[model samples]
Target: MTTTAPLPDAAPANWVDRYAPAWSRPWLRLGRFDRPTGIWLLMLPGWQGIALAGAMAGRAPDWKLLVEFFVGAALMRAAGCAYNDIVDRDFDAKVARTAGRPIPAGQIKVWQAWAFVALCCLISLGVLLTMGPLAIGLGAGSLALVAAYPFMKRITWWPQAWLGLTFNWGALLGFAAATGVIEAPALLLYAGGIFWTLGYDTIYAIQDLEDDALAGVKSSARRLGAGAPRAVAMFYAVAVALALAAAWTADLSLFFTPGLALYATLLWLQARRVKIDQPRLALVLFKSNTWAGLILFVGLAAGAGRV
Candidate 1:
């Protein structure tokens, strides 16, 4: 088992010091802002949902709404991370890779963390207020999922399921933002996003598998054991299938079909890479989903008559 030491308490280093503005580093750290991958992952599904909704409605997506969704996702994801860190501070301290996070490393106190969370949430709410009433209500309802997520690991062997529910919420919000209502196709896309999160998050959990076991944390990676790769493949298959069903229901054009095929190919590659258990490989495969998602969004946008 690999054990990560707590990062030293010192001045910000490298690009964090030179490029990141001095005023933002602490708050950024609070939100794991240095890790933009999480933000990208959170935003893509929302974009997909918006694109699909636009396609279904036979119009170009509202660019302002898309921008609003992006801003909201970034703010809320950061806020969610802050809240998660505060809730999991003790557990984070025990996990090597996470032991050096802002909270567990003592760079930020718990109360301060909560305050930061509130600040981020306020910023997010500001963005939410600009959306339609239905979007606002659906967005508010997501709070329950976010609030319950950090505690799921303590009681459930499938906390990844909870994460799937929480992380893919943007799918629902995006559709609502575009159409001002939720419908069957939007719900199907949201379900696909859930399975997508399950597959990717399971790969992510592998990085902490041994640590989680020793620390009494539960994850799908730990539960799946040697069959982890196979399980991921199965979940990805379901995700792709559901996504295709969503595209079909939305009456998307031929352009979207090729993108769906590409996405399925990418999932196969991810599954293949997961079988190797190389951390570096896993990280790369996870990051690749960002590109895969972008491609799918492009296809959807193209089919929706937006360039």
Candidate 2:
């Protein structure tokens, strides 16, 4: 499995030299932007929400709304990562896997990072304004969650729960974007996303368990101890069930059933593959979830377009 190497220079490298100005590379690294997996994870729930909304309305989803959601997801997810790096700079410096992150490795200054975050937020706000007023409001509300997320690990054993809330806000925003209103089905999808995040993030946290423990960081993986796999299974089970419930509540077509089943099978396989004692294996399993999310999205999109 390939992993991104941290930026090499001790001092900030020229933006043009790194990712090239045209690519906006400096901003991307500041947000761990090179990692496509994070954007996919962030965007899938929003897509699922939009598809479910379209299903509820018995219409094909607006393609423009879908495109807008994608753009918003990329910007917001990048911004969130930048915020996390700023907050976790000290903690990141202590962890081998994260020690080379832009902020901690001295490739980016804190205030400059903050400025990057503001710029990303501005871009996200532009996308938000293009959505419904309800979505725009909800998008604004999520700032509180994003602001609080970086500190959750310091104060609580379940930072993944906080992350769940922060990450899944897109579900509500997506539904509003699709239907111009928030509804019960969207709420259910958002709830399910929370559990799904818990499951996957627990697996992700497993990779950092040792470093986290040594650094006095708290996490569900450490809390679950030797029972990490069992806990992940329970979380995934709830996620699958809730996701199906969201679809059913929205009265989606039968086309969604097979996709949901496939997703369930994927989760089961992921659960079985989690090695509580092996951090690298845990990271691998966590990354595999990006595929799981995409598969689920394809199913939702298919179901949204009833023949």
- Per TM-score, the best of the predicted structures is 1
Q: How well does candidate 2 match the true structure in TM-score terms?
A: 0.91
lDDT of model 1 at position 237? 94
For 151-229, candidate 2 gives per-residue lDDT tens digits of 9999999999999998888888888877788878888889988999999999989878888999999999999998989
Candidate with best lDDT: 2
Per-residue lDDT tens digits for candidate 1, residues 212-283, read 989899988888999989999999999899888888787777767778888889888899778435655666
lDDT of 1: 0.81
TM for every model, in the order presented, reads 0.92, 0.91
Model 2 residue 161 lDDT score: 91
The deviation in Å at residue 230 for candidate 2 is: 0.4
